[model samples]
Target chain A: MRIILVGSDKLTYFLGRRFTSKGDYLTIITPEEEAAVDLSRRLKATVIAGDGSDPTVLQEAGAYQADVLLALTDRDQDNLIACQIAQDRYGVPQTVAIVNDPDNKAIFEELGVSVAFSATEIIGSMIEQQTASEEIRNLVPVAGSGVTMTEVVLGPNSPAIGRAIKDLDLQGAVVACVVRRGRVLIAKRRSYLHEADRLLVISEDDQYGQAQKVLTGEGA
Target chain B: MVSNLIGGNSSASKYIVVIGCGRLGSLLAGRLSAEGNSVVVIDQKESAFENLSSEFSGFQIVGDASEMATLKKAKLDKADCLLVVTREDNVNLMVAQIGRIFFETPVVLARVFDPAREAIYREFDIDTISPTQLSADSFMQKLNTHQVSTSAPTEGVA
Candidate 1:
């Protein structure tokens, strides 16, 4: 994938490295010259030094040809503007913005921009997994759209625990990954269940409600 | 009976609008309503009011409080005070700025999720509350004051 990352922060650098390691073409745009140098060296990705909110900078960074554009500046307004410009003007296929404030995620979503709440995307999912029941929470992409990833966490007292991953009888959910003690465990048919381990599951919008019940035991 | 119900001439009812109907919004709304003052809530998600009291009798609007349309729906123009308690610092800042600049609301309170962003919100002359920092500070204060008992349990206590 050709990914255009707009930000100079540590998180941007971290994501750049991940994309680079995946052998994906990555381009980074930042306002700081030092960040551009450091990240380019670290991730071996193309780095452009300029304000990401500027259309000329984005065009120079080759945002028009990018498969995914990430606007992850520390400033929410700047990130929103960058994503809007990338999506609306440059016609980027997929534009994601990192929203520091979780509440702003909705507004971004309303504006047709995919938002990744660093806090909620990571911490909330972890908490949800810790609080879910025994049924494995399947991770599924949003229906008719591959934009959003959804998962259900089984509460602690759920009856689904102690059962094998393949035995859950989930209807329309798929288990993508399982996280335990900060380790991402690949989902397998015979993986044994562990309490407080989060099953990274995904389901379409229509299947989310039923998937939540099958995984958490309350929704069913 | 009417005379008994009415307070002194100096004591007037204060209307408050609480944006973002999350835990903080619900609590503030309940508290203000309990004080015999009018309260209004604005939230994007309608499900946020699941835990709120029905008898509270406050106006609830399902929309982004930061937007002028939603704020006007909540009567931001006439509100005596505004509280932005959404989980996002940017939304809170936007709401506070709108309240201050457009509506000229007397008081605007905003919840800053990130401690690092507090100073930027403060620059707008809005009251900012950092739950993460404040909670940590309170915990440190308790530790420094030795309020938490450090004594070990005696044998066979279990």
Candidate 2:
């Protein structure tokens, strides 16, 4: 696949290297002439020195044939405009942008960029999730699916302890499996819950709170 | 006329928010406020606000226009119009998109230095002014008028 990566020299170099190794055509656009020369020597990809947000620069970078355009510039506005030009003008099928300001995620998505993410936002949420509750060891929300995977450890006084798997009214959540003393146990109707057993629960995003409350006996 | 385009009733003062606070932003804000319309100018650098004239009577915000918090502080959602005149074309375009798409501000105008980027702004239904293109057109018209009047190159220069 033809790919165009704009800005963030280090990220461009790494991604360019990875994609080129997979036999994908990679083009890197940067504003620094010196960096362009250096990157061209280091990577097996075309390197162009120009403003990423400029339509002429993107045209020169072969954006028309690009299957994907990744705008990883530190400046949120530059990334946004680059992605916009790539998608609207060049007709790139997929456009990904790294939003420097987490608050701009909605703005980027609303503007029609295929994927917009913020490293700070991801890290911030991960930190919050880690410290949010003691019983929930890990929680992950599947992107665009409205499904959540939660790893909850049953406590001694938990209402779910000593109850059979089928008897636990999880409010539409399903118990995928259980982990006891690091041993994976597939959740079955006859399998009984035990204190300290880690349950991997899969549920709709909105039902996770009730599911967790049922298992851990605490409001999430 | 500006008030009418922004949907403000005739004889009523319209709220205008100008981003950048550069020469154009300051001057436009000053003129709008002088016209009895409420105006607010925003700039990343506080020193940029020094460009505003004494006749200007409006709020000044020192903040980045790309951030929603800053725009919220400027009450951009409540503004009748938004003028994005930042020196950076991408910045002007980005802020204009936010105002038009998120805040739904009426009569959003942005200054894009790169003429090639005007298409993106147009596709988003945001109005844009390209100074580079405008100046080039003006220069071309002047050159064409001179050529039509005089055939001799030396005479045209003189």
Candidate 3:
């Protein structure tokens, strides 16, 4: 996959390394020449030293051929601009932006950034998840839809442990996949769950808590 | 044109929503409110709103203008005029576009820093004032007048 990364932050470095290590064609646009030089030395990636928000910089970064454009700039403005320019001018298939302010997530979505995520919100959610009674961790979301993909770890004494996948009163929820003792399997309708089994469910925003409740019902 | 219609006395007081509480947004919100228009000013940082005059009677929302939920919370759908004056030209353009596209606001104005953003605004049929262009024009005007005045004789200007 041809990927264009903008910004020289640690997140940018991490993503660039991941993509480059996979041998996915990666082009990084960093404003600082020193950072670009440092990154290019470490990874087999093309580097464009300039503002990613600039059309010329994006053009030099092979934006037209990029499958995904990640705007990881620390500045919300730059991220917004880079994503917009990428989508508008380059027609990049996917554009993701890292927003500092959580409120800008919705705004960025309105502004047409394919995915806008905030580190603060993610951290807050992780902290909230840690404090919560159930050990339900959010997995990847189902692509463009509002439906969320979540993994629920069934505690030893949970309600649905002994039940079949179809037996759980999921209420419009579907078990996409299941992981048992690190073994992955397709969730058959009659597939049974065991204690410590992880079930990945595709559910809407409002259905998440109910799904959690059904999976992690009354017990320690 | 739309701004003029909204500002005229023939119409009822227009609902104005100003995104960003920077010097320009704060002053504009205060002035618009003082002129009997209903104004709501939004900013992510609460401290930025201290720039507004104490006499300002408009509402204030502490939130990001780019977020649709924040706009809904600010009741921006009812705005007759919207002003986006965020520090970043990109943010201002996005917010202004939201005002134009989502809310169908009668008049949407944006404060843009980069002169290149004027084309984006024009593409969206939104109005924008770029400080760079304004400054350049003002500087050129001043330069021309300065040269003319300096070259002219004291009493009999050529």
Comparing 1 and 3 on lDDT, the stronger one:
3
| Weakest lDDT window of 10 consecutive positions for candidate 1 chain A | A133-142
Q: Which 10 residues in a row give candidate 1 chain B its minimum summed lDDT? A: B1-10
The candidate with the higher lDDT, 1 or 2, is 2
Encode model 3's per-residue lDDT on A65-90: one tens digit a residue: 99999999888878988888888888
Model 1 docking grade = incorrect
- After superposition, the stretches of candidate 2 with alpha carbons farther than 4 Å from their true spots are A127-220, B1-10, B151-158
List the candidate numbers ranked by lDDT, top first.
2, 3, 1
Q: What is the DockQ of candidate 2?
A: 0.69
Best by lDDT: 2
Q: Give the clashing residue pairs of candidate 3, or none.
A: A107-B66
Q: A1-220, model 1: which lDDT tens digit per residue?
A: 9999998878898888888999999999989898788877888789999978677788898888988899888776667667766776678889888877675677667656765565557787887767454354334445668423554455687656787778877666666877777798998988876767677776655666676666667764
**Candidate 3 docking quality: incorrect, acceptable, medium or high:** acceptable
Evaluated at residue A188, the lDDT of candidate 1 is 91
Displacement of the residue B95 alpha carbon in candidate 2, Å? 0.9
Superposed by TM-score, candidate 3 places the C-alpha of residue B16 at a distance from the truth, in angstroms, of 0.9
- Candidate 1 has a DockQ of 0.03
